[model samples]
Target: MTAKDLESLLTIYKEVVEKIDLGIHVIDSNERTVIYNKKMREIEDMDIDDVLDKNVMDVFHFGPAEESTLLQVLNSGETIPNVKQTYSNNKGQEITTINHTFPIRENGVVIGAVEIAKDITKLEKMIQENVYKKGDTRYTFDQILGNSAALNEAIETSKRATRTTSSVLIVGEIGTGKELFAHSIHNGSSRADNAFLSQNCAALPDTLMETLLFGTAEQAGTEGRPGLFEQANGGTLLLDEIDSLSPALQTKLLKVIQEKKVQREGGTEDLFVDVRILATISEDPIDAIAAGKLRKDLYYRLSVVSIFIPPLRERKEDIDLLTSSFIEKYNHLFGMKVAFIDEEVKSYFQEYNWPGNIRELEHVIEGAMNLMGHEDTISFDHLPIQFRHKSSSSGGSNDLEKIEGLLYQPDKAILPLDDYIHEAETYYITKALQHHDFNVTKTAKALGMSRQNLQYRIRKYNIGKNTHS
Candidate 1:
């Protein structure tokens, strides 16, 4: 072939090599880079001047990985195909890729090695973003509202817990806002910019749980998809109802938590994962251990910073505030202005024991809101039948007799006759309500007043403060 023909052929080859999207590096057995392309520079976020005609190892830092495929291929005269690698280049840009590296041989002798890398940094980033909503920060510390000493102490502890990467264990009854604490902690942490994932340990079987939490290897040429751990790489994972895990699974979880790495199913390498583990359990820790439901070793590792959430009944002082907040929430939702909760209704709420905690109270209020018609207040008549009977059954005729005998003359009679009559009328109205079994509808008729007038008087005097409707 003529010299001009060879020159034209060389130019065509250079254009083809430069246009390939994958990063390509060709190094001779001596380890000096002979061919470097624009696509390679783009993938590594470096310039051609830095890597062109330079030593391959000097331009790319490839340690921390158990083996370097290109370095191995150059020395062994063999092929290494589709090996996954995660490392930062000399330019300080982090990259993850699948490399097809092998030797280029001539006359049955190894001449050089070529590395073609498929960049996966973008794909992994996309997976992380998928777990979280772009604009939605679901929960924050401000959302958890309460003022009791126990609740306030827990809140302060939770705020401190968010600043560290240590494991957190939230202990509470079923509906005492364990999940809310989990979300708030994640949002408040440095991992707020990354993903946040939650999985209920009881929601899946032990075998399936392993695959879902650690990840599964994909079929054929595609790479394995990330699991909850990989997806929440730099963020938090709430293992809700973690006591439901079997002892076998508990052992596995302990290893993952300690190692800070996960070995995917059908995949050989242990991928390093920086995930914050936040776990929730409903049972008392001591009782759970005695019952063989929660493993002691696993609990020790997870409860590095433990938080105990008090039940609603224990924080009764906040019941009035919570009721008002829920009322406002429903008012905007249902387009109804529920002015207040009746005095009789508040009394019953204070006396009853809330076994199901705050969640049950919210449901009870929501039920009353749905049943409310034109009335602006939530009365005992609007309560669910079960809730009404909870208080009425325990209260009986003794309460009425106490009110009847409560009528007492003022120390000094008021000079204004109208004011005196009003004071006396308020007292008589209270007696009539107790006589009618604390039923406002029945009491109004017996007192020869309209139902609206009886309600007005009850509010005016703050009457029936201790009555159960």
Candidate 2:
């Protein structure tokens, strides 16, 4: 061919290569980049001058995965098709690409390879659309309402913690909404779609706890069951009241947390698991250890990222928000049109110590709504007995005297008031004692008093005549 004709042909070839959207590169056998098109420069957000003649490895880091693919293609002198890679451009933006590399031949001898890479970021994003959208419910950050600094900090910490893979331990008093925080973490996590399995350690018996946590083998009378751990694989597992777990079960749980594996009952094989463990303890694990109820090693493992939920009394500012929310919920559930709580009732709720926390508050509002008979508003009359007593006790020195003055009054007046006061005290104390099944420790907790104080009262009032020592 004539020189002019050859030059024109070469120009035409260059134009066609430049017009192609896929990035093209020719690398010599030594893995040195030789020729590259403008598309390659554009995709990498780099100038041709910065990349040409440079060793491919020197120009870009292929990560462990892409490096392996490159090595295979180079050693085999064959095409490596559809090798996916994720890399950042010069502008520091992540991009996904599907790369194809094939050996180049010169006179039947492999000289180098031609690499073509097609941008697949958009395609990859479309594939992940469902995963990205998972667990995005109607709830948002605003749904967690509390002005108290401690609660605000906990919420912020939870939000940040959601971005990590660390296990979380939530410790709080009973009814303080530990489960609520656990659900919030699950909903905000990447594994939210899998499953959120919760098990109350105290509620399950030792004989069944293992079967409930790890699957039980199939038997003649019963179908095989996948326990909470198995069901929560690739998701999250919430162990509520972790401190209440039996010592033997605690050992088993520690093993699972350490190994990320669980052995099903009546099965020899161990199953791999990928569940994120979240545990809660109403009682302090340290105290549990002192009481010989919880294993120290298990406590340490579960408490890797610990969160202590302040009691309602500690965060009194949140009482209004929590009460309002409960009022709305119970109003709907009880078929009540209650739109607002009386200001006095709100004050009483805010001022009174919520020993039972959010769960107790919910029950109180439910009870009030039921008593209102679907009234449009909740007033002081609808308040629970304890709450009403709290309001009355705060009225003035006169009301204060009714409680403290009982200790030192004339025998004549005391004779009549004593019976009345003692009757009221006995009623509540008996109810609390029964509610906690005569466990003095728990009854003291429910009554917001020390065990010693409760013991004294029980003795003074002559309660539990049949059981008392």
Candidate 3:
């Protein structure tokens, strides 16, 4: 190559090195600094005049006989692997940096040593914070609260899954606490000390998701962004609702999981990342794959540790526990003094088919607390009309016998449809009024009616004035 062309190439290379976020320094064979980058200057908080042509050891305050990785590399003419260290800047602020030193050669002869230092002060802080905050008590296996065989098996499976690095796939209906299981598994895993980053695949578009998961290169925009994989490195990544990922994005994600590397959009380099994958779906992944909504290969990869959270209705034994938990949560949040769910109200909750699962239960509890005001006990009066129907339909044999014995006898024929309807409405309205402390507004809303309408019905049915309001 011509000397002019070589000089131009060298200028471009130097400019590129100077602009990197990592500190770069070229030291002569004598172990003196020959060239240094802007990041090196900023890391030391120094002006060009203060650092130029200085011996590498002279710039920093190092103890005698305490050799640096750079010094060792220069002396042995060998490469030194990345070494993490703390150095004080000119402002006396200590920062963490990873340094790698290698011998620089010219004409096959070692002429100097080149060192690259990357500032990782923030990363170090995050690591320390994660280590110290290892035991977050937001959730536990006991929080699952179920005695059903299905639930017990699922919990056992989750416990087993936590011991491995295999990817997990959780499937359940909406509001079934799929995310809850994900959190429990992450907290139970060996990587509990690392960050647990979760993102719903259904929440973001393909383009945005790609950028969020794999980041963007410097050439893509002015500010380079780190992807979720990079941020969750050495941690767990929960991809909630993985079934919602488009086919194209599925291919990209498969590549990342398989290779454990990500090439940012518009960047040529592949970055290695270590992250445990946990994915969730509300639908049957096998059916979804058949329908072409999800990729088969991706499903197989994620199903290495599969778990299915049962809907609330299937685990009736846990209903009371979940109800009490929600009531406590809302009681503290809304400043309500509610202390218990009366048998009548608990019966209603247990009977209701919780299609929306635990999340729906939470909403129902919050709604009941709001309607019950500061009452110490939640009663059937606070339940909605649909819930009342469920209660009457599913209440124990004793409750059925009581209702039948009070209204009719075995010798009598079935009551007329209108009479039965009237009795049911009367029973629910009376119970609702009592639950709401006789507040017509709340009772009406719970029954999906207006105050005037409820009042008219109340007068027509000749219901008693047991309510105070």
Which candidate leads in TM-score? Answer: 1
lDDT of 2 by residue, 1-469 (tens): 9999999999998998888878988878787777789888877778887777877666675555446345456668878765666766445667766677788878977788887887656544433442122244334456676799988788888888789878999888998777778878888878767677666677646655676678666543234556667777788888777877788888988998899988887667788988899989888768888998878888788777888888988998887788788877776676667888876567657656677887778878887777887567787677676665654444323333444335466653454775767766876677557645688875675456799999998889888864331
Selected candidate, larger TM-score, 1 vs 3: 1
Q: Write the per-residue lDDT of candidate 1 for residues 257-374, one digit (tens) a residue.
A: 9999998867878989999999999978878989999999999999999999999989999899888989999999999989799886887788667888889888889999999998
Question: Which 10 residues in a row give candidate 1 its minimum summed lDDT?
Answer: 398-407
What global local distance difference test value does model 1 have?
A: 0.80
As a TM-score, model 2 comes out at 0.54
- lDDT tens readout by residue for model 3, 1-469: 9999999999999899889977987888877878888998876677776666887667765445345667777788888755655765445676666677798888978889888986656554534453212244256676787678999999999999989989999999999888778888988888888877877788666765776688767631134567789888888888988988899999999999999999987689999999999999888898999889899999989899999888888888888878888888887898788888887567567656777788878877777777786579987677555555554445433343545423468676677888867776777777668756788886776566898899999999998766444
The TM-score obtained by model 3 is 0.56
Better of 2 and 3 by TM-score: 3
Q: Tell me model 3's lDDT, rounded to 2 decimals.
A: 0.77
Can you rank all candidates by TM-score, best first? 1, 3, 2
Estimate TM-scores for all models: 0.58, 0.54, 0.56
**lDDT score of residue 364 within candidate 3:** 71
Best candidate (score: lDDT): 1
Clashing pairs for predicted structure model 3, backbone only: 381-431, 381-432
Give the C-alpha miss distance for residue 336 in model 1, angstroms. 0.7
